[model samples]
Target chain A: MDYFFIIDFVQSLADGLLFGTTYALIGIGFTLIFGVMRKLNLAYGAAALAGTYVGLGLFLTFNAPPFVVFLASAIGAGLIGLVVYYCCFRFTPEAHPMASLLASVGMLLFLEEMMTHVSHGMPHPYPSVLSGATLELGDIWIRGDLLFVFGICVVAMALLFWLLYRTPLGLATRAVSQQPRAAQLCGIDSARVNALTFVIAGVLGGTAGAMTAAAVGILSPIIATGLTVKGLIVVVIGGLGSIPGAIIGGLLVGAAENIFLLLRGVTERDIYVMLLLFLFLTLRPGGLFGSAATRD
Target chain B: MKLKSLITAGMISASALALSSAAFAADKTVRIVGFGASSGVVGIFGQNSGAAMSAAFEKINAEGGITLADGSKAMIETEYYDDRCNAEEGISVLRRIASTDALVAIGPTCSNVAEPLFGILQAKVDDAGDTGLQFPVFTDVAIKGGLAGISEWVFRNTPSEAKMYDDLFAWIRETYPDAKTIYGGVEEDFAHSRFTWYSVMKTAAEAHGFELVGEAQWLLNDTNFSNQARGMRRAEPDVVAISAHPFTSCGMLREMARQKIQPKVLVGLTSSSSLETLSGCANEAQGIIIPTSFAPVNDEAKAAAEAVAAKGGALDLHSAAAWENAMILRDVINAAGIEGTPDTLEADRRKIRDGLAALTTAHGLLGENKRMPDGEAVKPYVFVHAQGNAWEVVHNPGS
Candidate 1:
C-alpha cells in the first residue's frame, strides 16, 4: 500500500470512531424512544440540533458558564421531546404505525425550519464543554468531552436499566409497553405510564443532543436529519425495541463504521455501514438480541 | 463642465438613435429592466444587489432621465425578475427578461449561474450579430474568475478570489515570514470554494514558501466533520486553510477544538469574514485570522455600508461590493452616455459593455481602485484576528 493510503486509512478509522461517539449518543435516544413508546422520534435528530440551538441561544444570551450551557441544551431538547410526544404520538391512531413516523417527520421539519429562522438559515457556533481539557492515552488519543459524553451515555443507559427492572414506575411502564389493554384492564393507567416513559426517553435524547453539541461544536439542520438516519441505522442493526440491542447496535455501528472506513475510504465508508444494516435486516430480522419476548 | 454635459447628451441620443430610431422616436417612455436572483437561500443577496442598482437608477432619474443623442430627454422605467439562484431558472429568467422590452440586465448571484448566463449573453449580444437578444449587462458579485474569458460582452466589477488570495498570501509572507507548512480542506461541492482552495490558494502558498501539508474535501451539505478533522491533525500542518462556507467550517473547527488539536497559525479566506463564523464556532473559533474586504469596524467602509444597511440592506464586505459596483457602473454609463430607451437596448448595451471593459479605475466604496498591471482592482482588505469572542482588526495590509 502507498504510505499515503496507509496513513489515510488509519486516520479515517480514528476519525470515524471519534465521530461515532456522537452517533452512539443519538442511537441511544432512538432506542429509548422505541423501547418505551413503540414509536420513532423522527424529530430525534432535529431535537438534537434544536437542543444545540437552545444551548447556543442561552450561551449567547447569558454568556453563561460552561456546564450551565450543557444543562440548558439537555433540558431544552428534553422539553422539545415531550412536546413531540404530545403533538405527534399522544392521540395517534392505535392501528397506524406510519402515523407516528409521518408526524415525527413533520416535527423534524418544523424544528429545522425554526432553527434556520432563528439563525438566519446559517450555522450557529456551539461552544464546547470540555474542548481544551482532553488527555492523550497511548497510541489512541481520547477527547475529554467525547470521553465524558460516552461515559454519560453509559451511565444513562445503566440508570435506565435500573429504572426498568427495579423501580415501581419502571415496572408500570414496562407492563404498559407490553400489553397496553391488559395493563389498562388491570388498572395500571397505561396512558400515564406511557406518557412518563416518553418523557424519560425525551430526557435521554435531550442529554444526547447536549453531548453531541459539545462534542461537535456546530449545530445545523443537517445534523438533525443525519442523526435521524444514523439513529434508524443503529436501531435497525441493534434490533428495534430492544434496549440492550440498541446499545450493542450503537457500539457495533460505531466500530463497524470505523472499520469500514479503514478498509475502503471515506466515500465508500457509509456504504458498508448501510450494507451492514441491510444485511442484518435480511439475514437476522430479529437482529442480534431481538426475541419473541419483545413481541407485542 | 458644459462641454462634458453636452457630449454626454449627444452620445446618449446618438447611441439611442443608432439602436432603432423608428422604435424610440415614437415613444417618450424608456424602460430599463432588471433581472436577478430574488428568492431562495441566497435570494437576499440577489434581491439587494438589484435593489442597489435600482437605487442608483432612481437618483439618476430624479436628476432627469438619460439625455438622448439630441437635446431631448427620456424617462426611466424598470422591471424586476426573480432567478431563485438556480442555474436552469437563471437561464429561463434571462429569456424572460429578454422578452420584456427592457434594456440591459443586472443581478443573479453566482458564477455557475453567471457562467451559463454569460454564454447566453455572448451568443446573443456579441457573437450573434446583435440579433434576438442584445442588452448590456454589469456583473455585481460572482467571485469565480472563469467568466473573464466568456466574452468581451461581459465584465465584472468585483475582484476575483484568485487575485484576492494571491495578494493576501503575498502580504502574509512579507509580514510573517515565520509562517510555514499548511494543512487544510476545501469545500469541494462549491465551485468557488473548491477552485480557490485547490488551485489558487495552493499555488499561492507554494509560491510563498508555505508547504502543502494535507488536504480533505468536504461537501456543502456535510455536517459531521470527524474524518476531515482527524486527517488535518495527522497532517500536523503549521497553517490550516479551510476554504468553506460558515455551516461546514464551523462544524469542522468545532471538532478540531473538541479534539484539542491546536495549530500555531490559522488563516481563513476573505469570504469567511462574517458574523456567522462566530455564531457557529464560538470560543473554539478564536485565534483564527481571516482577511476581509470590509469590517463594520472599518470607519469609511463601515459608514458607507451602514448607509446601505439603513436603507434596508445588510452590509458585509461581500455585499458592500454592490455599492462600489453600482457607483462604477454609473461612472461608466455617464461617461459613455448609455442610451436608456427600450428600442436602443442593443446600442446602449454595447456602450455599457464597452464602458465596463474600458474602465481602468473608478472610485470604489473603499479607497482608491489602485488598479494592478493585470487590470484587476486591488480592493482594500484587512486581517482580522478572532480574539476571545470577537474579530479584532489586527493588520491593515492594504495601507
Candidate 2:
C-alpha cells in the first residue's frame, strides 16, 4: 500500500473511534430503555435533537457557554423522555410490543415535524467548546472537539455504570428489568423505575446529540432519522439489552464504516455496514453479548 | 289587487336575475395549484417557491389579472398543497389537483419526486390511448437536468445544470489558468447532487484541463467528513468542488476548515448559493463560488426578492424561478386567449401547454430567458462568491 493510503486509514480509524463514542452514547440510550421496558423507543433520536434545539435556543437567547448548553440539552431531553414515556409507554397495552414501537415512531415523526415547523427546516451552527484546537501526534492529527466529545462520553458512561451497578436505584432498576411483577410484589415501584430509566437514557441521548452537532458544527432537523437508524443498528449489534455490548457494537460499527469508506467509496460503505449487520443477524441472531434466545 | 301583486312579483324576479348574473361574473376567477414539501425536513424549498409564486400572483392580480379571449378580466387565485417531498404524496396531490378546475400547476420541489411524477403525465401531446393526465405542469425547483423532457405537458423554469457548469468551468479556466488540479466531494444519495457532480461538474472540470485528485464521494446527511477531507488534503488540489445540498455542504465545508484543507479556488453546487449556507457555515464557506440565476443585484431581481421576503421567503436560485414561472404562466394565459371558465378547463390547460411549447423566450430577472424545444428554460446566470456572510457577485457572464 502507498504511504497516502496508510495515512488515510490511520486517520479514518482515529476519527471513527472518536465518532464511535457518540454511537455508544446513543446505543446506550436504546439499550437502557430496552432493558427496562423491553420496547424500542424510536423517538429517542428525535427527542435528543429536540433537546439540542432547546439548548441552541438558550444559547442563542442568553449567550450561554458551551458547557451550560450541553447541561441544558441533557436536562431538557430528560424531561422529553418523561413525556415520551407518558404518551407512548405509560398508557399503552404492554401485551403488544409493536404498540409501543409504533407509538414511538409516531412520536418521532411528531417531534421532527414540530422542529421543522419551528425552525423552518434551517440548519444552525452549533457552538464548540474547543473550536479550532488540534493536537498533533507525529503524523496523526486529532481534533480537539472530538477529543472533548470522547472524554465526555467516557465520563458519562462511567457515571451510568455507577448508577446502574453501585447505587440503590441501580439495584431497583436491575430487579425491575429482571422481574417487573416480582419487583412490584417486593414493594418496589416498577413504573417509577421505568420512568427513571427513560430519563437517564434521554439525558445520555441529549448529550450525544449536542456533541454530535458540535462535532459537525451544524444542527438541523435532518439529523434525527439518520441518528435513529444508526442507534438501532448499534443497539441490535451490541445485543438488545446489554450495556457493554452497546459500547463495543458502536465502536465496531464506527470503525467498520470508516474502513469501508477508505477501501470502497461512500456508496459501498453503507452496503458493507449493512452486510455486517446482516451477518450478525443471520449467524449470531443474539448480537455480540446477547444469549441464544431473544428477549421480549 | 291582482295587477299590483303581478307587478311586485315581476320586479322581484328581475332583481334576482341581475344578482345571479353579477355573482356568476364575480366567480369567474382564474385558479392555479401549487404542491410541494411545504412542511418537512426539506420544506424550505417548497415554502420559498410557494411564497415567491404567491407574491408574483399578488402583483399580477393587483395590476388587473390575465385578460381572457372575451375581453373579460379575471383575478388569479392559487391553492397550495403540501406533498412533503414524497413521490406517493406527489401523485396523490396531482390526482387531487387534476379533479379540480386549476388551469396550471407548479412544483413538487424534489427532483426525485418530479422524475416519477412527470412520468405519469401524458408524454405525447395528443395520445388519447395513453390515458395519462393532460394537465399543464410548470415546475420551478426540481432541477434534475432532463426531467422536463419526460412529458410534453410538463415544463420547467429551473436552471440548466449542464449549461451552468459548462459556462462556469470555462470562466474558471480563463480566470485561473494555474488552477490545474481539482479535488471535490459530492453527496451521493441525492439525485441532483450525484447526477450533476458525475455528469456535468466533473466532466467540465476535466474538459477544462483540471485533473481529479482522489475519489471523493460521501453519503448525503453525513455529519462526519474527516476521512473525505483527509483524502483530499493528501491530493492538495488547487480547486475544490462540492456538489451537495446546503446542509451537507455546510458540514463538509466545516470539516474541511477543521482539517485545514484550503484550496485556492472553491466551487459549490448551485443549491448551496442560499442564506442557509451562510448561516450554517459562514466562516468556512467564505470565498466559495457558485453559479446562480438569481441575485438581488439588479432592480427586477431586487423587487422580486423583496416581494418574496415580504411573504416570509428568501429568494434563492430555485425559489426565484417561481417568480419567473408565474409571469410566464400569465403570458401564456394571455397569448393562448382562453376563456377562464370551469366548463373550458381542459381546453384551457391544453392551450396553455401549447402556448408554453410555442414560447421561444420569456422575461427573466437577469435577462430574457430562452426556452428549448424540450420544455426547459435557459436563463442567464452569474457566478457569486461567499464573502463575509453574503454572496457577492463575482462575475456576470451575461453582461
Candidate 3:
C-alpha cells in the first residue's frame, strides 16, 4: 500500500509538471509585457483566449488543419495584443499607472463577456494532434498531449530567449525596458518598441492558449477568467517581470496543486495553494529570481 | 361617369381593408417573461429554453393563438431576460416582471437563483400579511429537486431527479447483475452535482446491492483530474458513477482513460447527457449511461427537436421542457378563461397558478407526465449511452 501511494504521488507530480508548461507559456507573456512596459496586462489571458476562439472558428468553419489553427491563433492574438496596447496601456498617462491597470481590467471583462456571447457559453471540442496518447513507465503514465505542449513551450521559450539576446531589435527592446529615458536619449523609439513587445507577448499568449485548449481537449468561455487568475498567480510566484521565474513558478504551482490535492482532498486543496501564495507574498516578495530592488 | 364610379369604389374598398387590418393588429397579446443565466457557462440552457419558447409561441400564434374568456384571440408573446444566474439579479428581474403585463414567468435557470426567487413569491395563496409578489412562475431548466415547494405560485416542468436516479439504479441492478461495487465522483463546487452524487447516486447504488468502494470530488472548472483518477483507479470498482456537468465529466473521463481505469459500468449525472459531453470527449465517454427526460424518440419529440433546431437551439432535456411549458400555457389560458388584458394581469396570474396546481397530468413530447401536488413533474425518461458522438437510447423505462 505504501509503495502504491508513493507511486501515485510521483505520478501526480509528473502529470502536473507536464501540464504546467501551458501555464509557463502564459506566465512568459505576462512577464514579457511587464518587463518591457513596467505595467501589468490584466487582459492578457482573455486576449489569448480570443485568439483561440478565432482559431476555433476557422477550424469549425473550414475544417482547417491543426498547423493552420495554431498559426491563426498566434496571428489573431498578436493583432488583439496591439489593440489591447492602444486601448489599455498606450493612452494612459504614465504618471497614473493605475489607470492603465484599471483599463486592462475593463478590457478583461469586456473580452470575457463578448466571447461568452459569441460562443453562447458552450464548451467546444478543441482539435488535438495527439489525442489520448500516453507514455507508460511501469506504474506511472504521462499524458501525450501535455508532453507535446511541454515540447512546444520549450521551443517557443528558446526562440524568445534568442530574440531577446541576439538580434538588433532585441537590443533596442532590452535598452527600452531597462532604461526608457536613456534609450530615448540614444534615439530608440520607445513607443514602437513597446508595441512590438506587445505583439510578441500576444503571439506567445496565443500559442499558450492553443496549447492549453489542446491539453484539456476542450474550450469554453468559462476558462478565460480562470486562466487569467492562474497566469497572474504564476507571475506573482515566479517573480514579476522575470521570464525564468515564471517558468519555475508555473511548474512549482502545478506540481504543488496536484500534490496538495492528493494529500488533502479537493475541498481543502485550494486553501493550501492559496496559503502558499500568501507565504510567498509575505516572506519572499522578491520571488526566486527577482531582486529586492526590482520590487513594484 | 363609369370611370368615376370605379375610382370611388376602389377608394371605399381600400378604406375597408385598412380598417380590418388595423383591427387585426390591435389583437391583444398574453405576455410571458423568461429570465435565466444567458451569459455564463450555463448560458446555453437559457438560450435554448428561450428559443424553444419562441418557437412554441410562434406555432401557437400561427394556429390562430389561444381562446380568451370573451371568445377573442390572444397571441402569446414572450420576452427573455438575462439574470446571469445570480440570486439578486433573478429576484430583481422577477420583481420587474411582476410589475409588467406578463401573465406568467419562466425560470431563473440555476437552482441557487431559483431558491431565492421562489422565496420572494407569495408564501400562501391569499395571505394578506405576506407581501410577497403574487405571480405565477413556470420553471423549465433549474433541475434541483423540490424547488417548487418553496412557493405555491411556483411550478416546475423540470424532471424529478430523485425518482429518475432511483429507477435508473433499479434498472442497472437487473441488467448489470455482476456490477457489485460502485465508485462515486462529483463536482463538489456545484450544489446539484454534490447533492445528487452523495444523496441520490450513492444511496441508490447502495440500495441496489452495490457496495460502495470509493469516491472522489472535483470542481466544475478544474482542468486536471490526475489525482482523482488515481483514487478512482485504486478502488477498482465495477461501476463508476459521476455526478458532474458535461465539462468536468468529460475531463474526469478523459483522465480516467489516461490512467487506464476501466470500470464495467459507467453512470453519469442527468446534465452530463448533453451534446457538450459528446463534443468534448465522445470517445472517452463511450458506453457511459445517463437517464434523461428528453430524447428524439417519438414523432412529437422529433418535431419539438426540429422546431428548436429551426430556432437555432438544441432541445435537450431542460430546453424540451420549455417547449412543453409553452403548450401548457396555452391550454391553461384556454381552460382558465384568461382575458390576457392589462386590467386583468393580477387575476390572470392567479388563474394561471390555479390552473397549474389543478393539473394531475400534463401532455409532454413523449407522453403524459404526472404532475405532483408540490409543483414537480414525474417526467418520462430513458437510459442512454454515448455512442459515436451521439446519445443512443439503451433502455426506455417509460416503455
Candidate 4:
C-alpha cells in the first residue's frame, strides 16, 4: 500500500476506536441486563434515545449546558430502564424467554413512536460540547467531540468496574448472576438485584445515547432501531453476558466497519460487518474473553 | 271550502320541496384526500405539506371556492391521513381514500413508499383487467425520477432533480470557472438521494466539465464520515457535493470541517435546503449551496411561507409544492367541468384525471410550472446558500 493509503488506514483505525466507545457503552447495557436476568431487554436502545430526547427537551426548555443535559439523560434513562424491567420482565413467567423478548420489542416500538409523536420526527441538533475542535497528530485528525466521548466512556467503564468490584451491591449482583437460587436461599433478593442491574445499564445506555448524539451533532427518532441492532451485534460477538467481552467486541466491530467502509464503500460496508458477526458466531461462539461458563 | 284547503296543502308541499333542494345545493362540498408520513420518521414533511394544503384550501374557500360545471361554487374539503412513511401504510391509506368520495388524492412524502404505491394505481387510465385503483394521485413530496410515468392516474408536483442539477451545474460552470474538480459522497440507503446522485448529479457535473474524485458513498444515518472525509481531503477537489438528509448531512459536514476538508465550493442535496439543516449544523453548513424550488425571497413565495407558518408549518420545497398542488387541483376541477355530486363521483374523478393529464402548465409560487409529458412538473428553482443559520437566495435564474 502507498504511504497515503497507510495513513488513511491508520486514521480510519483511530476514528473507529473513538466511535467504538459508543458501541461499548450500548453493549455494556445489554450485557449487564443479560448478566442479571438472562433475558435481553431489546428496548434498551429506545430507552437510551428517549433519555437523550428528555435531555434535549430540558436543554431546549431551560437552556441547560451539555453536561446538565447528559446528566438528565442518564437519570431519565435509568427511570425508563426500571419501567421496562417492571413491564417486560418482572411479572412475566420466565418459562418462555420469547415472551419477555417480545415484550421488550413492543416496548421498543412504543418508545420510538412516542418520541416521533413528541418531536414530530424532526431531527434536532444535539449540543456538541467541543464542536469543530480537532487535535492534529501529524497526518491524522482527531475530533474533539469523539475524544470527549472516549473519555466519558473510559470514566464510565472505570466507575462500573469500581461498583462491581469494590462494593456490596457488586457482591450481590455477582452472587445473583452466578446462582440466583443459591443467592435467594441466602436471603438475597434477586428481583431487587435484577432491577438495580437494569437501572445501572439504563444509565449507561443514556450516557451512550447522549454521547452519540453529541458526536453526531444531531438526534432523531431513526437512531433507535439502528443502535439496538448494533448493540445486539456487539453483545453477541463479545459473548452474551461478558462485560469485558462487550468492550472488546465493540472495538472490533467498529474497526472492522471502518476498514470495510474504506475497502468496499458504504453499500457493502454493513454487509461485511454482518458477515463478521456471522463468522464470530460460527467460529468463536464463546467470544474473545468469554468461556462456556459465561454463556447464558 | 275543500278546494281552498287542497290549494293551501299544495302550496305548503311545494315550499317544503324548494327548501330541501336549496339545502342540498348549499351542502355541496368537494373532497380531496391527503396522505403521507404525518406521524413517524419524516413526519415533518407530511405535517408541513398537510398544513400548506389546508391553508391553500382555506384561501380558496374564502375566495368563493371552486366553480363547478353547473356554475355552483363547491367548497373544497381535505382529509389528511398519516402514512408514517411506510409502504404498507401508504397502500392502506390509498385504499381507504379510494373508497371515499374524494375527487383526487395527494401525498406520500417518501420515495420508497411512492415507488410501490404508484405501482398499484391503474397504469393506462382504464385498464379493466389490471384491477388497479383508478384514483387520481397528485404526489407532492416523493421526488424520485420517473415515478410520474408509473401510471397515467399518478401526477407529481415535485421538483425534477435532473433538471435542477442540470441547471445548477450550468450555472456553476458559468459562475465559478476555476472550480473544475468535484468530490462528493451520497447517502446510499436513501432512494431519493442515491438515485439523484448516481443519475443526475454526477452526470450533470461531468457534462459541465467537472472531473470526479475518489469513490465515496456513505450510508444514510451514518454518524462517522472519517474515511470519506479523509478520502476527499486527499483528492483536494474544488467542490464537495453531499446528497443526504439533514441529519446525516450535518454529521458529514461536521466531520469534514473537523478533518479540514476545505473546498472552494460546497453543494448539497436540494432536500437539505430547510430549517432543519440550518438548525442542525449552522456553522458547518455555511456556504453550502442547494437548488430549491421554494424560497421566501419572492413576494408570492414569502406570502405563502407566511401563510404556512401561520398554520404551524414551514414552507420548504416539498411542503410548498402542496400549496401549488391545491391551486392546481382547483384549476383542474374547474377545467374538467365535473358536476359536484355523490352519484357522479366516479365520472368526476375520471374527468379530473383527464384534466390533469391535459394540463401543460400550472402557476407555481415562483412562476409558471411546466408540466412534462409524464405528468411531472418542471418548477422554477433558485440556488440558495446557507449563511449564518439561514438559507439565503444566492442566484435566481428567472423564469
Candidate 4 local lDDT, residue B331:
90
Tens digit of per-residue lDDT, candidate 1, span A1-296: 88766655565555455556566667767776776667777888887767767777887788877677877777777777778888898899978989988998898889876775565555655666566665664435556666677777777777878998999988888887777777778889876776676666666766667666666666565566667888888788777777777777777777677666456655676788888988998999877777657545
What's the C-alpha lDDT at position B253 in model 2?
88
Q: Tens digit of lDDT per residue, candidate 3, span B29-60?
A: 88887889877878888998899999999999
- lDDT pick, better of 1 and 3: 3
lDDT of 4 by residue, B1-399 (tens): 999999999999999999987776667799987899888778889999999999999999989889889887789999799988899989998999999899899897999999999999988976778888898999999998889899999999999899999989999989898999998788888999899889989999999999998646777668787787778888999988898998888888988887778888899998899988887788899999999999987798888999999999999999999999999999999888999889899999999999889989999998999988899999999999999988999999884
Cα lDDT of model 1 by residue, B42-105, tens digit: 4556656655555555656667656565545556566667776678988888888767766556
| Cα distance off (Å), candidate 4, residue A56 | 1.5
Q: How close to the true structure is residue A1 of candidate 4, measured as C-alpha lDDT?
A: 84
Candidate 4 interface CA RMSD, Å: 1.3
Residues A6-95, model 3: lDDT tens digits: 898899899889888878888889999998899999999999999999999898899999878888888899899999999999889999
- Over 4 Å off, model 3: A294-296, B1-26
- Going through the candidates in order, the fraction of native interface contacts each one reproduces equals 0.44, 0.77, 0.70, 0.84
CA-based DockQ, model 2: 0.78
What's the best-to-worst order under DockQ? 2, 4, 3, 1
**Least accurate stretch of 10 residues (summed lDDT) in model 2 chain B?**
B19-28
Comparing only chain B with the true structure, the TM-scores of all models are: 0.81, 0.94, 0.94, 0.95
> For model 2, what is the alpha-carbon lDDT of residue B234?
76
After TM-score superposition, the amount by which residue B302's alpha carbon in candidate 4 deviates from its true location, in angstroms, is 2.7
Q: Candidate 4 chain A: worst 10 consecutive residues by lDDT?
A: A287-296
